[model samples]
Target chain A: MVSKSRSENVQIPIGPQHPALKEPESFLITLQGERITKSGVRLGYNHRGIEKACEQRTYIQAMYLIERVCGICSHSHSTAFVQAVEEVAGLQIPRRASYIRTLIGELERVHSHLLWLGVAGHEIGFDTLLMYTWRDREVVMDLLALLTGNRVNYGINTFGGVRRDVDAAQMEQVLKGVDILEERTKYYITVATDEVTLINRLSNVGKLAHDDAVRLGAVGPTARAAGVARDIRKDDPYAAYADLDFNVVTATQADVYGRTLVRVGELLESCKMIRQIIKNMPDGPVTVKAPRKVQAGEAFSRYEAPRGEDVHYVRGNGSDKPERVKVRAPTMANVQAVAHMLQDGYLADVPIVIAAIDPCFSCTDRLIGVARESGGRGIMTWEQARQAGIEWHRARGIDFTRLNETFRCGEPR
Target chain B: MQETQAVQAELMKTFPGLGEVRVPRARRIFWNVPYAEFARVFEAVTGPMKFTILCTMTGLDLGDNLGVIYHLARTSGVTLSLGTQVPKDAPVLQTISHVFPAADLYERELIDLLGIQVQGLGEGPRYPLPDGWPAGQYPLRKDWKVESLEGCKLGQMGVADGK
Candidate 1:
């Protein structure tokens, strides 16, 4: 093999194409031998320029663009973005619209978490877990497709409320799917934690301390796994979450396994929440009346995505097009926590550890990118390659000073 | 806890350093605190009211000033949001990552999108924008125009300041 070493420290770009990350997000992992010394993350590869795109779109058109933000968590993004606009317009959605939104949001959570489970399983090389989780996830997506037009970007959200209304038959189908999903998710939760091989590979790996998770500003399952009990749904209580009661799962381990368990636990919680929303649903119009002008104002709206809290800030200028719209997905917050998770982990465990964050490469890509310093024999086993990537970041420089800024929680500035 | 007035008065007493609490339209009560009191105010609310959950954090470029919003909530049905606006020329806020770890991503995102400085955050490169994305080119600014199809390079449109 033609092997040439440029420096003692060499950096290799892991993605925008790595199996470990779902979106086209890249990471420069600097390593020393087989252990990661540091890691640098870069995004903006898939910068659909959704925010800029929102500026050119009409209020109605912005909803569709926001829905496409993440294929998995599209509903949450749409609901949050549309809700912010609705709030600025002072439009009150009908009771039926709110309940339908709650139902669809929970259903989206079911599929999203299941999809994550399947992907997480695949990363750890557990094909059985992948098969079972994805097989069951199809049911939730089918229910979503039945209620809405499309499966991925459900065109249910509008300026005031949902576009579709759920009748008794639709509710029955959703309830049936929820039952099956809950039962299957329970079974997977058992295997996720109890399976010896899975536990051995996941448990205690990518350990992030509670202080570090807080300092790095991890969110969703990443922070929850570190024993930080933060959930936008439970805290902010938008949609049906305000009416329904559910537990916020947390773990003290702050490792790959802890986040895995948190997600696994929430899968069941989402199932239960969906069932409750359907059972106690009210009858009314599915949408509220919205005006042409959004007026000039700025407000921030947040919803609990399957990954974590998804926030959108909308600034309207009394024009059809929004003045400015900014989106912050849960992954944006969780990416900073990756360096803490990878610092002491084995090179072989890098993919699995990164996957534990449930990091959305598409969302991350819209926000940042990692640049690698070239010049090295890029040939090695996956282990050797990752070790070198980690070393490269450490040598180039890795700092977390700005990751610790304080802002008011749950409010708009 | 059942009395909103009592809670408000108690909060005012607890944090005297917080100045001029304003009640905006929609009955939303806001605390206008100095930038340095950001962490203390967060702890006071979440600690006293058990506002243990973070809703969202946002940054705004308000021409003459930069604003950061933090929304917090509790099951007790009390949702309090805190907003601090810093001068645009010298924008800075204390790090609240100590009270709510979830602040980490929001702050990084604020820094990435608005170019607002979140003092004491372990410094890194701007996120969301590519490496070659022009310096000082904030996509969120009201006057930032991306020109046309041919003129735009990557994320830059070169619309020259204001139009």
Candidate 2:
């Protein structure tokens, strides 16, 4: 690898609409040749003003509005919001309701991690892994639809408790589905660890030091991968996590490979927690009758979403409508560390590095881009760019003589 | 809940200017602090009390004044919410982004939506709003009105009624 000090400076803008990003967010990367020196992010392309919109709606209505914040982690959003509102109303839900909430939460985690695995595989040019992971992801989605009646925005959460209840038949189906997921996830762990191409693409890339991970406030699997050991489900123990038995997965690698392993490991843990929740589900009312108007007070609620810790602040004004609602998604906490991780890395590794955070721009769209030219000179032509690339490879002692002979014969045309 | 009381006592003994420490719920504690003591109290929580991660910073338009709530949390799960109010005319406060880099985006959101000026926050372009957005039109301030563009045609084709 070339030393960081000797690389040439160049600025490349990746996207408000790049293929790597599923949502609209841009990263303006400054590269010292192929090695990235600095990176700046710009968000807010899909800003719908959900926080402001929530303030205008009633507490019950805002629950539905907040559920649409992120399509994948919709259950987590509504649960956090409902928890805050329930606290303000001084309502304690039944034990059975909490168990059902935990079950859905864990199921959402399974689907989200599998979805991320597929995206990560596609990012590294492994189309087969992407196809297989997504095909398996459907099992959790089907189970979610069976439980909540919707796949993407599962509107299962109400104010005091959950809106739906699990039956014996659904619980049995969930157990069988989780069994298949557990076995498949164990196989995925082997593939992630032993596959040479996948390991080569992931390991040692986008390394976020353990201290930097904590200092920059990285959360969820991103922080867990760095051995931060901060999961709200385990730490705070809300919504039946206190009763469920599971271990918080951590890794010492603190790189893209570690993030991949951490997420896959969490998949297995979530499956186990799902089975535990179904087996020990308490028998009682699934929901309590919460008052329409909440007293004047504020509550802070946090939930461990699949990506990270998601927090919601709800303030009531003695009316049915909420005074102010603030949502801090995990992506907001993790994106800043992306700038830190991109430093001193190769530009070719940008996609996996950014995707490693599982950036949810739509949720965090509540942004800036500035282009400044310092020491970098003019842009290079296609031929000059190819020459620069060849020279870069030559400096690393790569022998491209045979490839150069074939390229030289067809270049004039 | 015990952790909330412990932190509250620590803050009260450390800083006398803390207005009211209210434990409205089980795990949540709200501290009302004067605007001048906002940064100092935030430092106390993150420093001595060890609330390492800033969960979020919320800016609210409370009719007569603007309020800023700093939601700070520890890895062990206690959340300390420090709230400070400023006059609506001059909603300025010290920036805590230097201490917690996570507060940078939250502060910028306040700047864009609530029209709150955060001193010591370094230079950055407008966030969450386009460059051509009209100035002084703070959307979240409750007073900002959404205008009606009655005759404005959205597409290239002429209006149906040719108004």
Candidate 3:
């Protein structure tokens, strides 16, 4: 009788931490029957304070700190950061370095797109596709390790140019692996486009119109799927992107399937770009000697990360360390669009809709640990932690007579 | 490249506030304007100028003033940055989310980390900073002493009393 008396609307919280998602993010979803009426995103669970950390470290140290901003897009972040520094320092790297940067960048895009395709499949309960794409992803991963000395955070990007040069043998290995990836991606494309089941499942699940996409400032595949026709590689032309010949792939459906098609199309484009880069590979030093101290100036640099436009702003105060370094990870620009994507979507399609954007869900993680104190420690709640805080403050002779009213501070129970 | 220069020259002539727009390189441009003039100048920049895609807004401390550098560009890739400043005591700027919805979260970031206020921003959570972040203790400010952050270090916790 009590259950029957309840209203149709029900609120469901997805995550600050959740089992369904690989990363930690909080989403409060309001549902009416099986349909979601409203969705809210809560950030800060993974805030790393890397921006503030950059202000304290030297330029060289900051570049390393930036690489860890997102494990998946390490080169994206480092390249953006270094490009801004290079701009401020007024350095033009070698042509060979530019070619190599673009090659590795496209390769990274290939691996990232493959990884996303598998994740999207898994989200839709198509584990077979997940198993297949991930297996093929290893080919690109192996090539990355061969060139950059690591798999995830490749660390290929240095100040003036790339730290590592692609040798003839390494270039051959890359080409051979790309050939395999290209064939596999073509097959996956047919599966994505021709399969009726996947189309039915993902089509129109999360719709963001062209106007909404641009208005929301959606980036990368999210905006491309909605037909925004914007890509930093074409617009800003950082590194070797200026010399590369590739169309900015886009789709007009403004839905999950459109996002898939755009990514699949981009996978082929990356493969094509990589082959051209290798064929036109120049011979020169990979790096120019960087400055010991950057002059006083600022630069705003942008890179088309696998996700979208990655922007980095750096300011030097005539010192070895930078005065400011601000990183706008593509996700930061795309996360707000997720809220719009979930509007009126089915409850079941939440994972796929969020996954469709490939939400990095992290970049900044500047949290204070929840030590035993109550004042400025971590965001700890519960009776035990509450009592410890009161007792600690009492021992410190900090009065608590009126603290209850003040401490509440509108923090929900 | 001439189109970039033309846009730069047009903008300088159109807005009385944009002082000596600096084109350090062919594609990149930076200009200084008073914070009071930001709202007026920003409308023209985002509207007729067509620098609609906001890359980001950078907030920094400038001794006695708090400064904001708004970076924006159209699909063409020529970035023109507008730097403006307000006195530290009254750090406020109008929200541009009406033009670029991406500014919603970035504006929240400025509020939380830089302690700058937005005049027209809608209500939202504290953003990238957690709810527990104490008010008036902006971490990005140069004067916000690092010693206060001693209790925030990892592995520095104690066993709760009466265990």
Model 1 TM-score on a 0 to 1 scale: 0.78
Docking class of 2: acceptable
- Per-residue lDDT tens digits for candidate 2, residues A1-413, read 34456555677878888887788888888877687777898777778778877877898889998999998899999999999899989999999999989989999999999999999999989989899999999999999999989998888889778889989999999998998899999999999889999988898899898899988889999999999999999888889999988999999999999999999999988988987888788998988899999999889999999999999998899999999999989998999899998889898898989999998988887412222266322334346557766778889998677776977852522
Each candidate's fnat: 0.40, 0.60, 0.77
Collision pairs in model 2: none
For model 1, how big is the iRMS in angstroms?
9.3
- Judging by DockQ, tell me the better candidate of 1 and 2: 2
Mind giving the per-residue lDDT tens digits that candidate 1 earns over A187-275? 88888767899888888899988877766666788889999888877755777677888999998878888888888898888888887
Instruction: Estimate, for each residue in A297-316, the C-alpha lDDT of model 3 and write its tens digit.
Output: 99999999999988999999
**Poorest lDDT segment (10 consecutive residues) of candidate 2 chain A:** A367-376
Model 3 scores a TM of 0.90
Off by over 4 Å in 2: A1-8, A366-413, B148-163
Cα lDDT listed for each candidate: 0.73, 0.84, 0.84
Model 3: docking quality category? acceptable
Sort the candidates on TM-score, descending order. Answer: 3, 2, 1
Cα deviation at A5, candidate 2, in Å, is: 15
What overall lDDT, based on C-alpha atoms, would model 2 receive against the true structure? Answer: 0.84
> Of the pair 1 and 3, which is ahead by TM-score?
3
lDDT by residue (B138-159, candidate 1, tens digit) is 6666566543212323333222
C-alpha DockQ for predicted model 2: 0.31
